[model samples]
Target: MWDSLVLGTKPYKRYYEASLLTRYIPANSTVVTSNTDSEDLRSAVFKTADGEYTILLEAKAGTDKEVTFDFGGEPPVGKTFYKHVYQADVQLEGNAVIPSASGSFSTGAGSSFTDSDIDAEHNVIVYTTLPPQTQVEVTPLEPVVTAGQAQQLAASVIDNTGGVTWSVIGSGNGAVTAEGLYTAPAVDEEKLVAVKASSVQDPDSYGIALIRVQPAPAAGRADIPQFSLEYGKYAFTEALTITTATEGAEIRYTTDGSAPTLSSTLYTGPIFLTTGTKKITAAAFKGGLEPSANVFRLYKIGNVSAGPDGYDFLAYDGAEELSFTGTASIAYGADGLFFYKTLTGPVSTAGLFEDPNPASDDKRYYISTLIQDEEPAVTIYNAGFEMPVTSAYLTGPITNGWAFDYRSGVQKNGSAFAAAVAPQGTQTAFMISRSGITGELIQDINFREGEYELSFRMASRPSYGDILPFQVYFDDQLLGTYQPNPSGSFALVTTEGFTASAGYHTLRFSGIETPQESTVFIDDVRIRPKGSPPLPENPQPNPLPEEPELGPPLEELSNEGFEAPVLAAHRKGPFTESWYFNGYAGVHPNGSAFQPPPAPEGNQTAFLQSVSGGQGLIRQHLEFKEGTYNLTFQAAKRSTSGGRDHSFKVFVDDTQIGSFTTASTAFQPFVTESFTVSAGAHTIRFVGAAATQEATSFIDDVNLNRLDASE
Candidate 1:
């Protein structure tokens, strides 16, 4: 030890040495080792400048544990060269002693807050370190489970310090096992298990909980029912059943084939069924619960039935049916329906219509109902035999948009019914027949393959320049002239296209006479390649001649317009609402809602915005200006049958002024009238006036022009 400063030093009574320091040996390894009994070195200390004591020593520190030495007292404040040494006691009662520092447990990892794996057999200390004032929580929230099962659940506890014990709060198992993890009961059941843990080292380290339960997985459902039906046919239906079942099952169905809603009734009876396919489904539902999926399946019911035999095919069978009438209604029947008539003053020839010829081998014809001008109509269908038989075939006469005057048929191009005007009346029509060919250009069409005969009705007749002269073009080759010489039952005839391919081809029965029989009335025409059935008649029906058509529900007519809910019998109809709609034509339902393209000739509609004053006043709802307005409307006069002359007139006020008649021949403008409106709102109406001459007139496309207004 060395003392550098003795600030204003004053001598003490005991002469306390200024500083004393010395170093020499070891204890266990002899650091600062000194022999206390060594007499020869008793005076070996060299003198200091003022006799202050200072000694040098060696150090010996050994062992893996930390080594430390404590100074007995404070060192001199300003000492330059002083040293001290220590070691494990070499002679502490003859053994060394280890030293220790103030090492302790803490918030650091392994030293204190450590986490261990938790399992069925082992749960070591779980340490969650936190500041003294902080708190924490751990929870066991979501857990997974297997399919088709359920159980009770549990959660773990939590605390602040570290190692903790989790305890169950409710009724579930306390410990979570390796393979037997705790699960909560079903949601329908009451109690469940809850768990948590508390720390001991830091008192409030963390707290946590967990929960587990069975899952309510979605189930697989069976298929639902599917089908539709006609009223008179099947009395049975079907439904599908579900499996892996839950309770409170229900099933719903519809006869009209509409989809079932929740409010639909449940099926309870054993439904009857035929042999055709249909849809069926079953569902499961209870109060306040979501309905389970429907079990669906297709169930076949029955096949279509055939038509009856020997039924009458008359237009006015005295029954209220549209298509098949008299005796048994032919909704699905298919044969022999005829009506008897007699001789007439005038006849319809060179016009398209169906006629009964008992002169043929059979007396049956095929027919189907359709709608024309919104009125029920018919079409005779001859599925085969466009190939003419020399002696007999299956078609009637064809005309150029003009009616047959008697029983007119539905004219068509392909499957669609033909429109009235083919631009202009410039095309030809023929009366191709399968009866006897008494004249030339006619055919007997009832024989087997490889044979045909053609003839006409009357043999020879008076003729002018090029009268009744037309060539027969066979496979694009002119074969012979069409002339008749009325004769034998084993008729002689002419034909074309016998060497041509056998398929559907137009026979082109055309001739241009000098206004004398120019519209060829020649019949007996045919051609065939092979054998087939004796042939079925056309499906189009023969319209009644000037006859009344009584419809379903038996509607009657008198003179009063407001007396009944009749459509066409009234003085006026379709009112002012002439928009684009085909299903709304005339006063009848076109059977379907409006569709685009052909369904709506949106371009064709009428607006009766103008009329005469006294006959009809403008409805208060309509507004128009007063002026000398020029108005025009398009009119179509369909096939009509009643009396000799009938007028389809547009009435100005109450007086008839404008109209369309059979006289125009096709879709042509009829009459035009002018009316003066008294400045305010005025009304104009389109009316089909009833006349002494009976006829059916159909109005299709229409246009209205106002000299003063744009609309």
Candidate 2:
């Protein structure tokens, strides 16, 4: 022990104590031992006044007190010593025990070593150490290369030596260079290649990268393949087949005149023209090749003959019956016109309006006279069976109790009385064939013991020119066996003075029982009382009367300006007002309502706001008797910006008949389109389809009027 002298006096005797100081010694190059205990000594940490440096110590526990540390790499050239000063967390009882003061040492040539002769304080001691990392990693662990292509590989190395070895693991898979450039096998390879990188200083540490080889694609053209098909008018019964000559190529087609792309429907077999005129487009595509050129073709079909014009009358208000001799009549709400021509013998009616421009067709409608039957009459659900065919391979039960039964002798895609095939003009019609296996359309009627007239229009499939024989039976009794001409023209077949029993009775129209070679199509069936000459009610006597004041032109139209039942004002957000809607969940009942501003010739306009990715609509249910009407409406986009635009699709009773889109910043003139509506209540919906969020649309000024296109 040593102590200072009291009162500034010299120490009684200079006490001597044993002290030890140690530090790391660096070598020209480091060669770490493989022994696991050597690693524990390599974890020693050291610090100097300037900064800190790592030192690896090697010593035997409890047996050796002096520690020797190795700092790999050559020391400074001319420096006499290396100064090291550091505090350390050297011991652990339950927690780490860090030294309060740093230790100091110097290591170099001619370094001094002292034993037992040192200062009483400032004791430096050696503790533990840690091993430095000496490993490398291969980047791009998995790389892809073409079968005959080359790719470069890279490695990241740390500590000891940065140099690495390059090699491939799989035989015949690939070759590698000294610089790590790997070339895939010239032939297509089905396996993967492993390339390795090993550290030169520590041969046991290594890294590996995986290489995958893919087969190269074949060379081919970049355009679509050409298809073969003729363009011309075709009969409704015509079956057309399209073909292509490209090998290993796929053909795609579209029937709606749209451009064909890779996602279009694939064409596999012959196509049968079942409906009206269509624009068929087709293209071909192959792997690694350009799509082929598109081929377009158009076809039109119409009825060969139509029935005579029928008398037209408008029943106004609640009139049960109306008599007229003219060719056309105008009617309003709860009123309609019936067209008919007095028949001297057999009367024929236009089966279906096949002409695309029906506004110019005069023989598409027929009405003999208005007859009010007390009971519900059996009417043909779809006169021409023009409803869409859900599936060609599956049968669909129709409304108003109409169904198709597979007639004998007709094969798959060739069934008699099949739906969707156009037999009358271009409109869809049910097929009826003359086979011994009888197929019939049966309907039960409640007849009040009266003489009734049953009439139906029939046409022969133009593909087959043979005559078709059919029989009509009432209550199991054969009424008549008639042979219809195979001219493709719709001709009326009538059987009158058939006595109907009271209560329910079945009326069966059967196909030919005896085998024949023809098929007939029937449409527009009507059952009513025989017509008679009109009886005059009463004649008024003429007397002197005073002239009345002139009034404004009579209001012959109903709701022509959409100016009834004024709608309330609407703004934005969760619209709630009149007009039915497809629904917006809890946000709004219909997603639109009536707005106050920007009305196109009206006090109010329907406003539709965007609802996420869905559509909004405003619809009205109108009570129309029966008439052909030309329709018109006005629409515009909202003033708000920065959102998707809105469009309109007009539907009548769930069928989309017309549509228009608007993107104007200001309101524009009315857009017009028309469709004929039969007598009944139908819902007309003006839908606003939003392309994105916050898109707004406006609509107003709706009009409907009787159309006299033939005149």
The candidate that wins on TM-score is 2
Worst 10 residues of 1 by lDDT: 590-599
Q: Write candidate 2's Cα lDDT for 397-471 as tens digits.
A: 322234456641111223333322232212333434544455556656544556777766665666653556778
The TM-score that candidate 2 achieves is 0.26
- lDDT of candidates 1 onward, in order: 0.28, 0.45
Runs in model 1 deviating more than 4 A are 1-648, 652-654, 659-711
| TM-score of each model, paired residue for residue | 0.22, 0.26
Number of backbone collisions per candidate: 121, 26
Among all candidates shown, the one with the greatest lDDT: 2
Q: What is the C-alpha RMSD of each candidate to the true structure, in Å?
A: 42.3, 39.1
